[model samples]
Target: MKILQSKYTNSFFVLLTVTGLLSSCYKPKKHFLQASGNYVLALRTQGTNSTTDYLLSMDTINTASKNISATGNGIEQLAWCYFGSTGSTVFSFSYGTNNVGIGYGVREGGGLYEKGRFSFERMDCFGKGDDNTLVAIGAPWGGGSYDCQIQLIDATTMSIKKKKLTPLYMRDGSDKLNKWPTSIVVNDNKMYVSFYPLDGGSWNTDLTDTAYVTIYSYPAMDSLTTIKDTRTGPIGYYGNQVNMIKSENGDIYTLSPSSLAAGYTQVTRKSGILRIKNGQQSFDPSYFFDVETASGGAKVLSATYAGNGLLVARLQIPGSDDISKLWAAFDVTIPICKIAIIDLNNKTVTDVTDIPVHGGQYGAQGLVEDGKVYLSVTSTIAGEARIYAIDPLTATATKAAKIEGLEVPAIYKIVN
Candidate 1:
């Protein structure tokens, strides 16, 4: 295995002064302060055959100084991070070569300490985590025969708690060749797993105009029932976590991007948002937002809930697929197309202004904190990586900080 590393730093100091003179007495106050917490950035570097992953932590207020980095081998197509409550414990996932590498550490004294390492089968899709457990759904990476495995691991111990296997596919006995697990959410003693069915290939061109979510009772792994919706495609994509999010009000909302084209034919479907109300198993027939139409035909690539029934979304231009455009998706030289804020209540999308347009392998590269959404806007070739603070209410974006050397694809705010 080979390892590569790089670092850059920029810091800003804010000084506050107070002056007063009373009864022939003069007093002066001077102090410099920086913001608390650090922003964790996932940086991607493309090589001849694979892409390497790097983790960098920079002060939220100052990006110049006090930056730390962790380097690793090439990551698979998808990578994710889990931040603990204290903002110290972190778990990183890297998938490649028919296996998944698990890295765990704690942030201490302004650095990350590697505590342990583990491994899992290839193409394991991550599920949501609670206070104690982390779940992973396993399936075949390429089109082949394999049992769908579910592994529940103890979050703190990093040890397997339980493992269960289902049939080749869901219990429905469907003959679909590719049943890809997209996202998983555990709610009310049941685990909801969303899937995208393809004919039999790596590309998602043979996608059906339908949605499938299999519900299984937790811990027991007993098959409950499969929910179906012909109104939309899959709930989420392969490289995103925010596709299905639970709001503060307890309702669950999911976004779909059906943007694959088959041979001499295209899947003409409107990508939209679907909701599963709190305390319900099926999608609410009364709730649906046509996100594709809202964006004037642009498809939503990734999205995250930004409070108040609003979502900050990254959109791809219509017909921007690599197969159609004759360019590879992993080409770091591509620029981002657009960013917008979607209002679920009014079913509207307002484009955010004044951000650089760059292209990259897109995912849920956004985080919501203190009523603001922090997004990673990095270009593959033109400009440096930048973190933008977006106000969902005003639909405006302002540059927050910058990362040199690498294009950051994901950002997470970890409090200390």
Candidate 2:
């Protein structure tokens, strides 16, 4: 296997132009995949930029964070989703560039740090799922004035072979797929995608909001097929954020960044967990976790199933405001990242520990085995990013590793 390396820089313009030049005009034929690998985590790395030229590292961990290749622009977002088969570990994601548009890649690992390769052209990959085959949603950049299509790509080759699905928005006043696509996850053979339609629409001053999710099924991996059956979400909440994990018992738990109560609706605040059963279309109202926003309201930094009935969730609490410094032009909000152990059987949560972290501090990306939580945080006095491990029972954290090189470091983990 060849070791892939990337160079990090503030510029990606040259890389973008080169990526476009490498793509072939001839389209590849589709194949019916029999099986895939078991991917335990979706390790991702991104530069702390809030704009279009956001860069991403190809290898999640084990390898140093390097910028995506052959592009002059940069990566916007990097995410991973399982495709091909039930136990198959095959996964894919995309990085951004100016002329390169979007660059995508696939890997074959079940651990935190494993090697992978760069594959195809700049397809605006929105989200994906598996039915023995990889079914993805996105459209070509210059395809049309208004064009939305879902294509099925080869799991091994990472090439587009079939155009299977597309959005059929609300017609004659009916509802449709949300325009702002955020995240996608799958349970059983069903695909759950979260999207909000504020992309091309004008920003509204109204407080009332609408977020939507669609549940659909595609053909089996052996069939070079398409999905015609689709269902839209029922009348409910409005927002385009999603963080989901599938439990050992086949239950789907999705986290949202909205309040379930009134008055706190428009704060861009609060934390919530929405539960949905496997192969279901709507969320189970009874299984929801709503954290407060005032008086050090809790925020879910990250969450993952620790197997069995145990779900580990992370929370952060900001310190109280300074009344004496009200006259000052700017203020600092010190944050404390905490971990929680949730007893899913009883639908209850217990505070583990605050994990001793500060603002812009390193935080845990996801949960790990053995009830241990990993976090990357800055030493406020030391001014450096360090990795830490927290024990859930004692609610105490210990320094695990110190990330080198950055004045302020960004660290993420992947496990085999």
Candidate 3:
């Protein structure tokens, strides 16, 4: 770790003196502290929204710094294909065409087709496929439920294949797909598919809303032999980013966020931790986590078991609100992000620290590989989302690197 500078020391000392003299002291936080790392910080000029794709070469960090090997240029999404214990390789996919517009002005939320919004186009799977794999899923805006088809792409060619997979509900036993697919995850040799309903149309009004998880055996994205019950938890909680982890003793846990009602005051949304333990196919009915918020509820952005009944989670504070609400109550302070150290053995959740939100709207989206937490700060003021390396053990942040030119930084994981 780098030592605090003498100039900072003097400046802080003066501030501390003023704080002590004032009726209410304002203390400075160590938000911009520097720490040392052996890894390279690479920049790419040809990515999804930004101009670059980045693949960190941990094995070759000693030889190159800021040197990223590009997978697919001029694209928004990328994923590493991990062939289940056979090792891993890079496979990236960019929609051949632009379809949706920005969510707001020139089309708001950005273009759907241009930004990989049609399905899990925002998500990439990292698994070996025997010539057939569900590479992307989602609905192209202004399309029907059938518009939500799953693209079985050719891993080698990085091209969308002719064969596509759709849920039983979406198809007529023929090869039709749905329009409201949400998220996808692979577990225990079975593929879990979650689907939702589309909004703003005639069929959208007739849409009988439901979510499904279709499980299929490996090597075949075909034939949904078993339908897993995903309704064990609360209703109306849209699930995303399902992950599976196994303990050394052989117990399995599935972790994801279960979003609840919105905040009464702020634009914050509430979510709680959802855990399915002991190889169970469904969520435990009584296993709701305790996350209290008037506006934004408890949300688990990223979670991983740390063994011996401990789990580390990257949590975001409630700041996501409607623009009108923000304008009405304009003096709202930005909530500081935090990391919760959950001890399942003791059944307790401990607040680690105020993880530091520099500027406005910055939140943590990724996990740190070396037990540290990685946070992505979307500073409209900075015009980029800066990634920070948080030492969970010390509750200190080390300014790591920045991801520039993104509308917002989504989930990312450390590969090294």
Clash totals for all candidate models: 11, 30, 37
Q: What C-alpha lDDT values do all the predictions have?
A: 0.58, 0.37, 0.35
Instruction: Assess every candidate by TM-score.
Output: 0.78, 0.54, 0.52
Among all windows of ten consecutive residues in candidate 2, which has the lowest summed lDDT?
324-333
Q: Sort by TM-score, best first.
A: 1, 2, 3
Model 2 segments beyond 4 Å from truth?
1-155, 161-165, 168-178, 201-211, 219-242, 259-265, 268-270, 293-296, 314-339, 342-354, 358-367, 378-382, 392-395, 405-416
lDDT of 2 by residue, 252-369 (tens): 7655433211101133324555667766666665565554332146544345466665656644443322222111110012333445665555556666544444432111234353
**What is candidate 1's lDDT per residue for 212-268, written digit by digit as tens?**
777788868788877777777776655434567667777878777765421101354
Candidate 3's TM-score reads 0.52
For residue 154, model 1's alpha carbon misses the true position, in angstroms, by 1.6
Please identify model 3 stretches exceeding 4 Å from their true place.
Answer: 1-87, 96-135, 138-141, 151-162, 168-179, 200-212, 222-270, 290-296, 301-316, 319-354, 358-368, 380-384, 391-396, 402-416
Q: Is candidate 1 or candidate 2 better by lDDT?
A: 1
Error of 2 at 222 (Å): 16
Output the lDDT of residue 2, model 1.
Answer: 28
